[model samples]
Target: MLGGEEGIAVSGSAELRCFSAMASLLLRGIGTLVKSLAGLSCGQAPRCSSSSLPSGISSLQFSSTRCFSERPTVRDHPKRPLSAYIRYFMDQHVILHKQHPDLKRTEITRKIGQEWKALPDFVKEPYIVAANAERQKYKEEVKIYEDHLTPLEKKVQKAERQQKLAKRKSSRKRRELINMGKPKRARNAFNIFMSEHFQDASGMKAKEKFKSLFDDWGILESSRKQTYIQLAEDDKIRYENEMKSWEEQMIEIGREDLIRLKQRNKLKKLRPILKGPKVASKKKKTSVSRLKQSRKTAEPNEGRKARSRISRHEE
Candidate 1:
């Protein structure tokens, strides 16, 4: 019985040793996996020790990823100097203005451009030399300006840039949303007629031609107008078909808000029908005037004062 008890104690110690060994192996495996994952992220960064890294990863890499996130601030970026021709124009413009003070800026600009075009190569060489010197000076100044910025300043600039980009994106999104659900107005009969013919309008201005076209269409006979009416009807039908497909596309894209907006605005009120512009005739007043005149004469005469003189003579 003493030997059996000693054997049981030995077995218990062996089982404990096995568990310890398995636990150590698991820890080492986990360490190796972490090191491998870290290596993938680090790229070619210098290996540096950190307390946060897993065991057996003394030579682990820690990348300075913040460098890639920095965007160049436009205010600090290099400025391109004015070209030789522009510098020449500026100098000549001042001198030319002293000689001709009444010249408008626009006229002066046009004149300068023309003169620059007319100048010979040798005449332009001096301005080109001056421009090159200014460009070199600008490059040096820009380098100094960028080198003077602090880390905090750079962070502020980057934040401002991100905000600007976000604002632009949001504005574009709003413009797209504002056109929501409104049907594209189809071209009417007059528009279709203009598009098919009278495209040149005989060199008339657009406004004048538009007025002329409408005036001509107003006088068109019923049969002539019917042709354009048919075209307009067909165009409206096509527009409706296209709008239906567009709504289906919106559904596919899961835009139920746009669909609801479309439904809400779908009901159209009937427009009042109007007749042609011909003036209505006035009612005849000649009969009424004649009756008034006859009554006036009968009262004044009264059978020549009721035929008193003639009847007296007969009696």
Candidate 2:
């Protein structure tokens, strides 16, 4: 009788576990459904028409698929046409690869470049002409595409392009500065404290080390924390002074673009003064005015003397 009761208890626990698992799955499905519904209500798409749905798939399935798909991105314009060199390279690359199957991609490309250089102008002429034609066609297509885009869309696309260009330029400038052995920025009080205590938490995980250090710093006495803050302030002043001299050197070397934006603007405003013709000072102007007055008085006196000499000669 006890064995039978123990078996019944085990079965009951197993059934409860199964029911709990099913309930969790149901809850997950309902949560997903709620998210999909919320996204759909936000007008992610104007409306999912019945005509647009597949014959076999229900509206629900189609909507779910749309919800899971990636959001639409900014670019929809036609890709730019290939250059003449690229056109020739694409045509020859496959042939070269086949001829030298053992060669790596880079080696194949080098061979293609050699062959292209050896080829007569006549062979290259056709590719160049084709590229020019395609370029013209691309320009016309771009014009039509731009005309179709709304003003807001055009602005957004322009902003996105500008952002990409600025990011590329900034990264390039940073690389150039690093290569030039640019001075590092100053650290804050927390960072200074972290560096000092870094070895203490060496055994901890990367994230845990940071958390531990942060907690320690948080509970630190105000007087002790002030010492780190003072060091940070001194380091900051050193960094600013060093950066100022470094930026001046960069400007002298004609690499003004690597300097800070505020400094760059200041340089721009002062450019005319630095590279322009010199202006006469107020002292120089005054000396010139006095010389002119002396000349005027002397000229009148000389005229009077000349008139007296003419009268004496006439008598």
Candidate 3:
């Protein structure tokens, strides 16, 4: 009887474990379904519809499939490190697209994103591990390539890097020029100190200048920095309060687009636009009083020119 009872208890525990596993899976599936429904309800095409997505949003996925894009797009330049999420989605995108060749690229991407979100950590671990391995491999190869480069190659690489940086700067300058009305970020205590010494540091490269500033800041007594620090804190508070009020006003005014842009910090780059240098169509006129005085002074020269022209013709 004792042995039989122990056997029954073991079987019951096994059943409970099976039930729990099924329950967890069901919940995950339901959650995925709800998300799909929500995406469908929005009635907008998946954002990844285009071959090119916004920077830091999606990868430049080249498929043996359809083509779509919305904005002025450029090829990915100067590859940066990828995160685990990006790696997973990107790899999954190829497989899913190949399987459903007729589905829109954006549609596949939406499905992949949803699936990735639904996956338990354990299931994702293998992909993440593989991604990390690839990253390590890339780093090693890059180091080797750099080490093997000739002087010419090294110079070429440096020029390419500089060109990429210049492109980025030009893009930001354009954005700043266009969005001049965006609020300014408050300067901090360190910023004040830097402003005072900007002339001295102007000649240094960005990294060297920051290093020198750090050394100077380190030597300064805390008490002396306190006043500027307090001012910075106050300025930050003022900015935050103003930003909140501006956001409210934007909503009230029905400028949803501006609200989204502000949340994304896209508007922060805006400043008071400096108008282009005005070319005087005609030479700038002197003030009326100054013009009269100049006319009185120049009357003698005008008469001399007239006399010279008449005399030269006669001669």
Most accurate candidate by TM-score? 2
What stretches of model 3 exceed 4 Å from their correct place? Answer: 1-83, 98-102, 168-315
Q: Could you estimate the TM-score for every candidate?
A: 0.28, 0.43, 0.28
Q: Per-residue lDDT for 1-315 in model 3, tens only? A: 459889999999999999999999999999997686555522243445444677765665443222332333233333546777888888888888788889997888789888989999998998788778878877887777667676756776678779999999999866853474445679999998887876687446877887788788889898989977998999899888877776667656666455546564644443223433444523354466678899998999999999999999999
- Compare candidates 2 and 3 on lDDT and give the better one: 2
Candidate 1 weakest ten by summed lDDT: 267-276
Q: Tell me how far the alpha carbon of residue 196 in candidate 1 is from the true structure, in angstroms, after superposition.
A: 40
| Candidate 1, 208-271: lDDT as tens digits | 8777777778887889888988989988998888777777677678774555465535522111
Ten-residue stretch with the least lDDT total in model 2: 58-67
Compose the digit string of candidate 2's lDDT tens values, residues 2-55.
698899999999999999999999999999988866666434546557677776
Candidate 3 TM-score to native: 0.28
Error of 1 at 2 (Å): 99
**lDDT accuracy of residue 203 in candidate 2:** 48
